[model samples]
Target: MAGQIPMTRNGVERLKEELHQLKSQDRPNIIQAIAEARAQGDLSENAEYESAKERQGFIEGRIAEIEAKLSNVQIIDPSVLNADGKCVFGATIELEDLDEEKSFTYQIVGEDEADIKANKISISSPLARALIGKEDGDVVEVETPGGQKTYEITNVSYI
Candidate 1:
């Protein structure tokens, strides 16, 4: 089945930049390298030619992959999201752990843009799944690998 690939505006921009670089810089560089290598010798025994050809293949493959990703991207802007204090895609949510009374914040984002160090969780993650549709003061239960945990929604905002 075809799956959705949600991406933040920044993520989409990054992908576009990468695609542009591959097409404009990397592609031309590899073509030149291949041409130079081919000029040096026989078709069958030229190691440099073989290496350059391999590099060209890899670069082309990456270019195709990036193109496909860009084509399928669904861009989302956090600043425009309006869930009315309810957790949703592109929402930055504050939570208080029921057991520890400690607070944490996480932004629900797409898988491609999820970064644990940045406190951004994918929309399809277990924690995000539990938090979705919940408003401030709502309590959500999440089933984690460690155990069942409960968190109280403290705040939800876009951006």
Candidate 2:
């Protein structure tokens, strides 16, 4: 579909797992809580019932959101992508900080899968945007919150 969100295979799997858990476990638990709260009587001043209803609304909203995203998701597998050694979505990149000489590795992924702790960066991020379409040995400058930073692309691999 047009305007579908691009996501890695692993990202899609994680989303599916979360949706499943929410529907199977959380939804049922919330329903039980609401039923128990309803049994306490006095609906207008029932704090437990009100809280359960609010939680139910949040869970339902999240379920709809995840379902919509999954329906419009475009799964991209990194291992099967070929970009001619240039940086692109699903490409794992190795870079060296021009100023600090620090080496780092990151995989350009969808927004949902961006985790700094895991070295996964969103494709729309400043650094990822600068690195995109760049080849090995190329230097790119990125405008960051801490001012401009430069990095040299040491390697790019689809893994």
Candidate 3:
């Protein structure tokens, strides 16, 4: 539960693409900048050299972090899931607020792929924690920043 990260196929590819870009493009560019800065002499007084070194450090850190996450990933295809209509990771769920008369839809995903604007919520989020293992037509309570609220699940889909 703690070590392995659950990620969709698309999410895995996106992270991999970011790692590749940081390594193949950003890394080379920063190295080139550092070389050029070294040619200008005095590194202690060189802003360009300092900036490039900082950027290189950031890129290298990100590369390692992404690689570690990728290595511990448990890739799951939502389309292939069979949860018997119960809400689970990778499940797209629709909920209707019983109080405010509003509807919300979200797909439960890994932390790396969570984007509220895109309707993707992290599995560890408060609402997601409440929704997991729930079924359609089930009423659930969640503690939001706006205080406690109730929602009735309208639908749950793996895709």
What TM value does model 2 have?
A: 0.95
Candidate 2 lDDT over 1-159, as tens digits, reads: 357999999899999999999999999999999999999999999999999999999999999988998999999887787788999899999999998989999999999899999999999999999999999999999999999889999999998
| Weakest lDDT window of 10 consecutive positions for candidate 1 | 1-10
The true-versus-predicted C-alpha distance at residue 127 of model 1, in Å, is 1.4
Superposed model 3: Cα runs more than 4 Å off:
none
TM-score of each: 0.78, 0.95, 0.96
Model 1, global lDDT: 0.87
Clashing pairs in 2: none
TM-score of the candidate numbered 3?
A: 0.96
Clashing pairs in 1: none
CA lDDT for candidate 3: 0.94
